[model samples]
Target: MDNLVKKVKEGIWSGRTDHLENKESFRYHQIVELAQLDTLDTEGKACVIIGFESDEGVRRNKGQIGAAKAPNELRSELAKLPWHVSSEKYVVDIGTIDCTGNDLEKAQQQLGDVVNQVLTKKMTPIILGGGHETAYGHYLGVRNYIGKAAKLGIINIDAHFDLRPYDEQPSSGTMFRQILEQDENSSYFVLGIQRYGNTQALFDKADELGVIYICEEDMHGEQLVQVNKAIEEFFQNNDFIMLTLCTDVLNAAFAPGVSASSPFGLSPNTVRSIIRIVSSNEKTLSFDISEVNPLLDENNRTVKLGAYLVNEAITSFLN
Candidate 1:
């Protein structure tokens, strides 16, 4: 626990520093700080940001590795975003659970611990991820907080099912499968699954696990109504809902910085709409965005999209 909270130093060029008119015109860098999670009082309502800095999951999965550095990049970009919900909700920056020495499992365990703590405090936990593997850690925390019997609904916006078998060990591609295997009561839903991105074995695994998914091609072209209905039904049935987004689910044109870029994945607007839908539902417990590789990004497009999505989701929840 002592090593869990790594303080967030103000990033370079944090918010536009030149503005002086409203004095009240605010930005995230101005409000965010490294704070002790358990010590803060949100009165049962706050948004807690936690960073998951581990690429061992990616390495194990045999993907790119620079995503371990994504937490800080995400923070730097997020720091400049404008915030207008100070009165409605308090956004707490609870440092980061860095995978020091590249220890993925320990970092994940710590992430679960902090998430459980934040939930106990009755606050929402939003995780900035190192890779798709962050989903398992995020789920571990949610499960610890809510318990195994709770009906948990998982929504993944991605190009692939990420349900690959982890016979040897879990990776960025196997976390969802791990969750389902561990918890029978949990239900999983995925949007924007590219047909070409997944193999027959993965699709078979998803079907065997009873995972619900909409292919990228079907997510549009008159199938949108069914998509909305599916999401609504899932929300209604679950006791708590968790949303995880992997940037690789987006087309390379929009999200080229992911470990595995998609040639034809969902658009940002489509992804944002799904987030808003789930977020508006009060049962949505937590959200995490993953697989954003800033090292490979095009002018920080993936990072900025991530920041934009986070902003939109938080704004939706606050309102």
Candidate 2:
């Protein structure tokens, strides 16, 4: 047994497994330059990747362990993605977080720790996977760090407003609800929300909370103007912006691995255009892509696509 474990560690795995053969390996790939311990005094740039798999406990039971596997899978795929930006010049530390526990509060607290650590280093947190519910913790960290210094803006691309009543405690489907409760004055906008999934109650809540939602039918047919206008408005008010891309906002054909696969979503080109526009803006402090469940994916396509989106955003910064 010891020999088998040693061979797996030295051969198949990178010798960083949690146990002998039961746990997943670390999900980080430091393609860029590695920093020395002495450099701790300096503020370094980095993009943090995190995975949270307690979907069942969080009340988002779409992809099970697939959510937990996203950060590592996306990193593996990113290693192969051809970045349009030069590797050496663009030095970004890849900090991958592991959220293996089943407690939602505990998982969220752990995520909050990573967020604080990244912002402290003057690095933007480009997190991946876990669940949309993780956004609450992310926002908590942002509020704690920024602390009245900068007005915050939230740009969410999703198929649902996720503004369900704060009654059921808050899950992946209620992150924005918690977000609004925390900072109702913060500028928040939702793009590509399917008209069918959102309840009238949510629309009313959004209106009351000053949250903007651009529905799918409206965006695809006649609401393009509104979508563009909302983007402009969000930036005009808040200097610090966090953009979140929920894979379910894309049509199931493009992102079938999401927890709740929806048909009426933005096209790949449209989403890319949005990302490009946002990335080009100077206000964007950080970006995140969630709901990339590898288990539901047909052939690792979702992971690859998510990686491509990240690559495009990183490249856009160069342009």
Task: List clash counts for every candidate, in order.
Answer: 1, 1
Give the candidate number with the greatest TM-score: 1
Which runs in model 1 stand beyond 4 Å of their true positions?
18-24
The C-alpha local distance difference test score for the whole of candidate 1 amounts to: 0.84
lDDT of 1 at 307: 86
- Compared with the true structure, the alpha-carbon lDDT of candidate 2 equals 0.65
- Tens-place lDDT per residue, model 2, 1-319, is 1110011111211223333332132222323333322242333334444344445423443334456667667666765543344333343433444455546766676666656655666756666666777677677667767776678898888888878765745567778877777774577888887878777887888898888777777766455666777788888998678788888888888888877788777887778878887877877766777878888997887888888887766666544
What ranges in model 2 sit over 4 Å off?
1-30, 33-65, 91-95, 221-226
TM-score of 1: 0.95
lDDT (Cα, tens digit) per residue for candidate 1, span 268-318: 888888999988789998899899998889899999898888877777776
- Candidates' RMSD to native: 1.8, 7.6
Clashing pairs in 1: 159-249
Residue 221 alpha-carbon offset, candidate 1, angstroms: 4.9
**Worst ten-residue run, lDDT, model 2?**
1-10
